[model samples]
Target: MSLSPSTLSPPPLSLYVHIPWCVRKCPYCDFNSHQGRGELPFAAYVDALLADLDLDLPLVWGRTVQTVFFGGGTPSLMPGELIDRFLQGASSRLRFAPGCEITLETNPGTVEHGSFKAYCDAGINRLSFGVQSFDDGCLQRLGRIHDSSEATAAIKLAQDAGFDNINLDLMYALPGQNLAMAESDLEQAFALQPTHMSHYQLTLEPNTVFAARPPSGLPDEDGSWDIQEHCQAMLADAGYRQYEVSAYARPGRECVHNLNYWKYGDYLGIGAGAHGKITSGHDQSILRRWKLKHPAAYLEAADSERGIGGDELIATERRPFEFMLNALRLVDGFSLTGFEASTGVPRSAIQAQLQEAVQKQWLLVDGDAVRPTALGRRFTNDVVELFLTG
Candidate 1:
């Protein structure tokens, strides 16, 4: 017998493997990554990750994996043999759909060209390098371990390793940044010729070093806005498509793993501090799970039946907000049908507020989708607030 609509499961899945250690944490970084010393237990970590995936297997049955992303403090730091072992172990649990996108995130200072090439041979088809800036002073201010020259070399090395699908991560609105300086940073990134670029504006998030002791280099509001606008234009002129607020790509080089997140696709996150949202309908219910943070704690608890710290089942009311928060980040918002398909809710649920937003000129109303107007994107907090009636 065919499953009921409520019993229908999410489509082909994705996996996110988190590596929690970095050589040193940047002052502006607020991710769950941590700084460490001494030698790493690569073999042990790989075993733990596979064990974690084994616990998640029931949710992955019959679903082919379309993508795998190795993200973290610095995935490139893990020896190539460990990456291969991890992939081999994952394959035994779930089958990969043909031509799946496999990605590894690297920092310019960590791995050399030989190691990058080894990663490619180990089944990493894409490389995303953290090359925040090409300005020496900006690099130093950001506490990046790599210099401007090293950043350039890293990109060339990836290319030499036959990684045509590569991405560079850059940050603008940094401390002591001016419009001219930001432009120069973009210019250097363009010269690298990576298939994709993610240019994020630096924000002083709470609990970060910048928040505790305000830095001297951050721009004023007006200055920050100016820098963002000009940089967007620069990227556009350089043949990059601004697909999302912070992501740009050449033709078809957009990161599939990221697109999955934006479209509300299901993912399994493994490793310390990693959070996952899974939409499974096995028993007519959807569930989400999140693992604990702190590597030491996770490692200590890996043998248990449930190493995760928390799990939440999303309800009808909360799902729309979660869906829109991600979809709207795209320059062109998702289709109305996409909303229904992804959220399992009808368009009528949010139509009234959507109409009101259009009337106020806060959103652009296309027939099946809605997008923020320039003004709306500028005041995104207000736009999102209009949807909060609960």
Candidate 2:
């Protein structure tokens, strides 16, 4: 059933700016990134981004941006001068709410002490450092460029640059990784005292070099599970609260930009290979848009609006799967009313599946909200499947 367009609440405003070039592509990384050869045309790319934003303005007008995230392919590689120009142009076109969180993702290897200060001066208050591991051998096995010392220096530099809001990205379950290695990684990460941390279990995703020829000496299921549990315990002991499966943070330090996505908020995605979902109050319609993938092609292209490679107008039936897929990742999950409010669909649509999930002990039916049990989190794909195929 279609809800009345006038009665539906407007979605939150967020911006995701993608930078599609990296110093070098990691062996296990499948993200849309390529090796950078020489000087990058940052000004041209910024112009292209604004051009793309111009086309999306109609969908986001009169909405103040609450968060803006600059995600990979190594946003740290973007020259600080260019970032300042881009942010200035963006803010000039669209208003930013007071205290809006502006985050830039940086590879520890790419950022030095000076770069952190430059980034801060460019108006990026939050820095998410990609420091995958603290062990030298693990870093080598992961094909990461940065050594542990570099990572540590980068964190210290960010702090010195007046950035109190910082996040360290850590990965466990590496090839030949043991409990001691995992715990050490956590210890080193916490030593930085970052406001936020994302401890992810390494998965050999399809199409990556590691997946094609599965890395040797990798941990088995049981060993991986042990490492994961141990590291999570360490993070908890260090005062990091587990908000999502892989994300932990100090109190009030959760990534607001990511929260907008988990809450099914709308955002404008700009740059090569960036994907966006925007809901229109005009037609009560939800639209998904993705830009062209290649950096060279995206730059050479005349217009990015037509350069969009994928577009979809989501059907109401698919909203539950999309909404639940994101919300279920949270430790505290979402309320029944939240699901309805976010999707503008009735609560009854997934009632039978929700009841079955609780009955099967995969979901916790507590006051005001529903959350995945620890067992459910372990077998998350299966839990998601229950709703998908229910």
Candidate 3:
């Protein structure tokens, strides 16, 4: 049965630009990132990104962008001039919120001392560093190009350059990582004073080198659980509260772009291998579109339809599961009124699943707001699966 789309008031919109080149691809990474061969075509890529944005403008015409994220192999690899040009071009075409939270993902080894100021001048107000681990041995085992010391230095440089809102991405449960080592990594990260921290486990994704040859001494299920619980306590005690499973942040410093995503809001994805979800109130339909995965292919087709990888209209039946996949990740859970407006489906549609979850101690339904219980948060996969249509 093909499901039709429904809608109430449209959700807030955001922009995501993908930069697909990296100095090197980490073994555990499964993102669409290619190793740079020589001087990357930064200028040309920026032009292509603008043209791609021009193509997508009609989809979100007149909408104000609430947040913008530059994600990729390493967005910091792009020179400041190109980033400024891209943002200038984008703003000229679409209205950007006056105080839009703009973020750039940086790899410690790839960025220099003066680049942070340039990024700031280009309108990037926030930074997220890929500081996977502070343990040098763990860094080597993870095949990270940046050492723990370099990560520390790079963060301090950004701090000096006037960026106080920063996030450090750390991975726990690594191949030779113990509880003590994980604690030490967090301690060092605390010293850096990043506004936000994203702590997740090191899962070996398919098609990656790590999955092909799994690392030895990897933590067992019980060991991984121990590490996560300990890290949670450490983060909370340090004044960074866990707002999501892997995300911890001070009050009001939570990542706006990621919040939009987890709340199932709309966003435009520009550049190679970028995927976007947009809800069109005009047609009462939701659209999922993506650009070509290969940078070369995306560039060649930049200003035309050929640049588009594919567009999928989100069917009505799947909206519940789709919404839950993102919405349930939040600690406060989702609101019924907001859910109805975003999904265009009535709360009654998922009432059975909601009751089942509540009965299983996986969810707590208090009037209009629905939040996951601690048990539900731990078994998120199972909780989300209850909404699937069979």
Best by TM-score: 3
Q: Write the per-residue lDDT of candidate 2 for residues 1-390, one digit (tens) a residue.
A: 455445345668899999999988898899999888888888889999988888788878899999999998899998888898999999999999899999999998898777777888889999999999999999998899899998999889889889999999998889888888888888888878899999998889899999898878888989998888888888888899999989999999999999889888888898998899988776777889988899888877626456686899987777778887888888888887777766777777677888888887889977668899988788777777766632
Q: Which candidate order results from sorting by TM-score in descending order? A: 3, 2, 1
lDDT-based ranking, best first? Answer: 3, 2, 1
Give per-candidate clash totals: 2, 0, 0
Off by over 4 Å in 1: 1-12
Query: How well does each candidate superpose onto the true structure, as a TM-score?
Result: 0.95, 0.96, 0.98
Quote the lDDT for 155 in model 1.
84
Residue pairs of candidate 3 with colliding backbone atoms:
none
lDDT of 3 by residue, 92-134 (tens): 9999999999999999999987799899999999999999999
Comparing 1 and 2 on lDDT, the stronger one: 2
Best candidate according to lDDT: 3
* lDDT tens per residue, model 1, 1-390: 112344234744799999999999999888898887899877888888888888888777788889999999888899988899999899888989888999999999998888987898889999999998899998899899999998898889889988899999999888888999999998888888989999998888888998798789689989988998998999999999998889999998999999989878889999887878787665544578878788988887765655787888877666677777777778777787777666666777788878877887878987886888877777666677665656
Candidate 1, residue 314: the lDDT equals 74
In model 1, the clashing pairs are: 175-217, 176-217
**After superposition, which runs of candidate 2 have C-alpha atoms over 4 Å from their true positions?**
1-7, 302-304
Could you give me the TM-score of model 2 versus the true structure?
0.96
